[model samples]
Target: MSHHLASLMVAGGLDALTYSSLAFLIASGLTVVFGMLGFLNVAHTSFYMLAGYIGFSIASRTGSFWLALLLAPPVTVALGLAAERLLFRRLYAAGHTPQLLLTIGLAYVIAETTKMIWGDDSLALAPPTGLGGHVVILGATLPVYHLFVIVITMALVGLLALLIGWTRLGMVVRAAAIHPQMVDALGFKLSAVHTFVFLVGLYLAAVAGVVMAPMLGIYPGMADDALVQSFIVVVAGGLGSLPGAFVVAGLLGLVQGFGSVFLSDYALYFPFVVLAGVLLVRPLGLFGRGGA
Candidate 1:
């Protein structure tokens, strides 16, 4: 009985790790954008879904996973620019409710547009040539594609940490995050910083979509659940706190991944429940310091 219990725990841990990797990929971009811009950007998940479609279309036509990976980010960046210039900028000073409404509306528009372009059917992509098998570890079989997801997510996180910690742009971003009034008083172009941050967020979302499309088939409302999940992650991790986002996202992913095995009917809500509990205990979240 003890041996069986230990094996189950090991399997659950591996599964949690896999799911956490996916969640990290999905949430990191959200964390960065929200942390920097102070906007919820509800349409973030739409970008994720769109990237999956874009990648799928490209790969299906060209049979080149590399092309899909390389092309999706730039395309999403362009879209993000347009969105910021045309829509989001207008709501920047309109207060949070208005901004939230605008973003929610944009989410619907993007979803509908995606449906018109890709139809209401589901789509999938094959893993790249090199990452299309399984490997065994600790008496458990794990998909190679998941391994790729884990590696890519960890690399991106490291790169982001370096960029934010050691680079000029990162310095500006950190300054803005810590002291927006001071940054603006110093004559920094806050608008440009916001635009750059939005673009990067969109790029990350697109990459996640492309990579995850193989595992999760793309559909019309594919981003709805993701959007909710990410919001919970953001809230639970603490608003505008990147490190907090990473921690909460990993925690939620582990709970959802493992909880599903035991409570499939309520698994999807597990993260939200955790979020609620966290909010009740520490309203500012684990990492969030009182005001941005």
Candidate 2:
């Protein structure tokens, strides 16, 4: 193969990795919240978009990318927690239709708020100091920030696995997801668990937003796009399965990246195509519970 062609493929693969990784980070929170509570949060991506805009605003004001990264996700998490407490708490058992509509309304409110704050124009965020350059990996020159994103995301996933798999908190969250009544009977506060887990999920969304801000920028329409992509990931991977989301999001991300490279005009359809195929075969999703 020509050197140029090989370089193109490598770049495409990296792009795919980047997209898949970010998609997982963003979608996992929604998946977990649904898995445990069986309530889909349509406003989740609003948190992601808010994080990006917040990060950009801070970065632009202070001229410090590190500060933005450090500050944005926490702020978004706090906002999400507030929304959960004041708004979502009232709708936990209201069925999917009402929750969906209300969250959509909430998302709309958030989008308008962002427009009022940041204007309608997209805003750029520079990468942090050490990540402002490229690095050679496997004979390919790649953006250091991209590599940093991939590595940090891997660690994030690992930490998540440990939290959910090895810790008491994870056990409680999983048990609650599977059987809230049983956990309640066992003397645990189901509401507290739900609130805590929801915050964790929103925090993950914010992390994804902050991490991707440099590449994606802050824009008015980002919330809508992110919502679509995250929903696809959650549904395709299975409603409540983080591992399933990781695998499916990775594959779909690759499909999107390579499709855009090899078949640019068709790239936009890849996500829906994958989603349709997944639903046609396994309506419950790849790892979704039969009860779910």
Which candidate's TM-score is highest? 2
User: Least lDDT summed over 10 consecutive residues: which range in candidate 1?
Assistant: 3-12
Top candidate, metric lDDT: 2
Model 2, 152-256: lDDT tens digits are 888888898899899999999879887889999999999999999888888888988888888878788888898889888888888688888988898888998
Q: How far in Å is the alpha carbon of 151 misplaced in model 1?
A: 0.3
- Per-model C-alpha lDDT, please? 0.80, 0.87
Q: Write the per-residue lDDT of candidate 1 for residues 20-61, one digit (tens) a residue.
A: 776767776787777776677888898888888888888888
Among residues 3 or more apart in sequence or in different chains, the pairs in candidate 2 whose N, CA or C atoms overlap within 3 Å are 36-177
- Given candidate 2, what's the lDDT at residue 221? 89
Clash totals in order: 0, 1
